[model samples]
Target: MPLPTADTPWPPVDTRVLTSLADWDAWYSAEPERLEQRYEGRGSLEQANRPAQYAGGLRGRLARWFWGQPTPAGEKSSKLHIPLAGDIARTSSGLLFSEPPALISEHQGTQDRLDAMAKSLHPTLLEAGEVCAALGGAYFRVVWDDEVSDRPWIDTVAADRAVPEFRYGRLTAVTFWTVLDSGDTNDRRLFRHLERHEKGRIFHGLYEGSLTALGAARPLADHPDTAPLAAMVDAEGGLDTGAPAHLTASYMPNVRPARAWRHIPSAAYWGQSDFQGIEGLMDALDEAWTSWMRDLQDGRSRIIVGDHLLQSLGPGKGVRWEDRRVYTGLNMLPRAGDPDPITSVQFAIRVKEHADTCAALTEQAARQAGYSASTFGEHGDGQAVTATEIKARERRSLATRARKALYADPALSDILAAQLAVEAGFRFGVTGLDLSVPPKVEFQDSVTEGLGELATTAELLRRAEAASTETLVRMQHPDWDDQQVTAEVAAILGESGRAVSDPTMTGAEGPGTHGSGPVE
Candidate 1:
């Protein structure tokens, strides 16, 4: 890395500055490093596609014969990545607000239009699902191109590169980083988008690096065309084609109407990765497995030879008893009058104790990950696991999912807000949505329930007509949107040639009663 240029101002960072900032470096690099190690297994980098190392003993040799001692990355990391984080992101991505965002004007048609626009943007906003799993949180930015169209579009920023700047306890700027493609696709130029709020005005600045070697860690500059101080950014930058951007632009005033939402409240930084809390457990489990393998390999066999015969054999091989002049296979010579001279000896090693200890260790590791001993193919104590015990373990896993939802739900709301704002400018298809009024983000819990519990929920939904239809529908199918529910209802009505009238509608009779109105 290079030294930071003292003359450069804030928000413009070169490689040295980026890697130097304590929090920034930790967030973007250090944390990912630790998480990746836990996921791929420690020392994976050093091992890099190599075979396993075994001790020089009977146990080591036996392990190679029985298990083949082929060490691969993540062999220790059974990726107990339960559906918690994934389910949270997957469920939250498809969530809907309790009600459509309200408009300032009381025009029902306009409100409906806005609702339609919101529905259209729902799937786009949901693109952050896998992103959230990769990074504990996901980001949403509203973008528009003056030359292309006036309508705003969504830009989902990866959490690893998205930096939100706060000034006086308020978010004043957001900077996103990307690697710009150069002549070589593998090599890249670093680019940054710094959207800042200054004097009640939004300023957008684009930064590009000059060196192809910048690859992933290019330097940044306020001015685009000037050759980036590679020496100041990275000591290695001079080695690459230190070619700066041919085109440059000054910080230009942004005229877009949307302001970036730093994070959704539910998604306001509350995600815990599968590997987060159990990293130490994973490390210990890996070590235990590795040690167990060594024990199995080195302790399974032994060979012995008589002292006088050993000299004649010279390390397990010598001339046969029949052929005395030259060395021969599977034969040893005995001295004259040598009584009770054992030629060679071999014995099988009983590894029951070592095997049992390994099994126990494997079980303990699995238990730490909230799984049964059998999950990792280790039978501890040789006890059969019951169905009830499995179900209870599954129930315990729900806690992780519940915690993820607490953060993901609010973050989804922030993303939805950005999406709603972007969709506000659509000239056709959607109207009546007010970008000023934030929509309510409602997370539908999709955790598996017992059959009895599911029955109870179904019965309750069937009996209550006024209860939240959306909630009921979500309870049944968490991934379904209002549009899907409508389609399902339409399909059902089409079958009977009759519609189920809404009890809340004006002049409606009873729930599930046939009505003249066609389902929307």
Candidate 2:
């Protein structure tokens, strides 16, 4: 499809898409004000006026608690936000990338290139993974600049910033856009730079538009950011990528089906956000934390004194509590057997109650988000369990990580293949390298077995004569390649004097005889 032209609708996205993205972004940001604004914009006027009526379902109750019960004017309560949403996103990324995945290619040169790329792109991939988890998906675009780097580099675009075209649930093309300049609110002059990526070419266009409409298509040189790209544009207004069979961009969804927008066909291709389905639980968790803090604040002890006890500072000045040990001729007695004026008051803090509430909400949210409560450090009893017991506790989380890895592997393979294709087609770096095959993406295990446990298992296998030396070595160091394993096995045999020498054949003796003796 062609790029959006003049008078085209801005964003070209459904309202539901916008709303979902906005809510996910707000929660991922973990800003209390942002969340409050989102909740305020939802529901009806009656619901807004009577928050008690809003407490109907789980979400409504959470919203009521998070926004607080209706308070008198100028008596608004403080709300605190726990960054559990952000933590979930970060944990998702860490689970997948704490140990970088290996992009292995059969060809030696291609493997070398992949290794070099992985070294530089590991951190970028982690950041992209986090954003992907938070926003439901991310886009990987391959671009090159000889001035910046010799080879094509990868860039990540957040899901909200791009309009993707998919064929049969596969991404065919994507247009990434950014607002270069936004004029005054009244003027409504917006300069948008759009880069559309397709199989063999990238189209760049600048648009002078309003927030709701693309007013007109401007020349590339009209904007400072797009000016340099003017020199690269061909007669067709796109830079020929030279590789026509493959796309220069790929979409990596966080997870499949995008349950939140499954009803909306246009947005269904997007991935599901980590914060989806459990937003209310997270909000309630935040509310619990906020209420706990409020308890601390309101629990401070304060002395209640009569007007006679406080000394006047000066004219037009407020009275002050004199730091005196004793006062003479002061009215110490209460009127008509009333309570003492000098009584102290302090409210009790519901620590255990709030702690339990917060813990329960956090566990529910984590579980609802496809992770175990223990994944977020909510292990019951806080006991030190064996690795087997720990794995049992985090079975849900491990399964989740495996699912995410499955989704990521293909997208990563495609993008890395595109990168290699770009380099080989342009002859930019490492010429004559094979780019016909895409590399395989192998993610390291999220949970590694203890060395001692692995050694014991290997010993048992060896005792049963089931595992070979090479197999034992591989089990001990799963990260090692075949060559490393072979070398280690050979060294072990040689060091143990168990290396078998070829039997010598003597004419006098029978063939296949060992040493100088014949077969007995």
Candidate 3:
């Protein structure tokens, strides 16, 4: 059935909804802030004497070089410790891939078709979605035959572009909006709204632009294929239709029509940034390094040019002695007065201590992000060497990964399902197989813990008869389903030339008995 028109009144959004979305906007801004600190060394040094260091000339260059201050305000630097934390999280999270799960019958064929379609599209969906998840939450929209492109396309809208309408803690509708340049003689507003129907799984688009140089507001015409949208516009060029045409054009056989869209929230239950936890630590590390650099440059050296001695050199008292032997070498010159002529004394700052402290803070930051010292190539002091064992898994990194998977897995599945629906509707056949059965998508996780910890557990299970072979195999390969496990067991027995025996045989222990040997 067709969905309602865009002109129908939407449930009024609560004031808190706007506030919540604003928070997500702030969260998204953090990525650029982090990038600035990482590559540009922004806020690296805000010392009391920063203005002096920024004043151009030989003095500014000397202070910047010797004091470890950032480059002039507009330029960027190569300082990178802050970016390293973000890199660690991304690299350690592992590679996530999509495939058909056990839920779908003949899922392999469905998955292969989805894979081929993904390759044909630009800015592969995987890369786009990952970037959005890292920043906060993103809206994945599957648009077909947009004015900009003829091919079916997947576009990721940032959180700010997607306004999610909620009812009783569930998302009922999502309105994806954007701005366009209408190229009128006068600078006028041009807004576009593409809303998705949650119940009917359809898309409704409306464009409002200044139709003339006078800057008068009017509803723009619909695309040639979407003529039904014209009904929504009233005589005054306002929205009038209460329903929009089903926008997706499907060409595949056996594919049901559905919306191929997904909303991936980086953190569960709300939009949370991946870098929120470690941002403070990164700032602290930068501050510590900045302070150390400032003190090392300004506090550790002194020049003793006396007030009485200044008159001898006149205006040249600010000596150009940098290259002369008199700068570092001791020169005993005759003094006219008996009073001490030494004008100043400067003590060296504790450079080594500050460096060690910063290192410790950096390590703590890594730990908070679920990384160890070894992750950044740093060795812990007096660390113990113990046998490899499966340690407890409760780090922020792991938790974040799990939470993202919780959202991404289902979202990806829905995207592929929608694609299948479109293909089936259009009867656009696959290469070799019949895509009659809708395929369920599953994401394959190739990321593991830092120490290859799973290997030790697998070895222990193989060496000792801790449980039934099936149970052991399941533990080792958690992603494997029951059928795969059974097939593996049968293959093993066949290779060993052993016959299977029933556990409930005569004179044998019945079910529910403990301390039993391997099932074979």
User: Per-model C-alpha lDDT, please?
Assistant: 0.41, 0.82, 0.47
Q: What is the C-alpha RMSD of each candidate to the true structure, in Å?
A: 13.5, 4.7, 12.1
Backbone clash pairs for candidate 2 read: none
Tens digit per residue, CA lDDT, model 2, 186-266? 665898888999998999988997777777988889888888999998866688787888899999999988886888777
Q: Please report the TM-score between candidate 1 and the true structure.
A: 0.45
Q: Quote the positional error of residue 340 for candidate 1 in Å.
A: 11
What TM-score goes with each of the models?
A: 0.45, 0.88, 0.53
Cα RMSD for candidate 3? Answer: 12.1
How would the candidate models be sorted by TM-score, starting from the highest?
A: 2, 3, 1
Find the candidate with the highest lDDT and give its number: 2
**Which of 2 and 3 is ahead in TM-score?**
2
Q: Model 1 shows how many backbone clashes?
A: 16
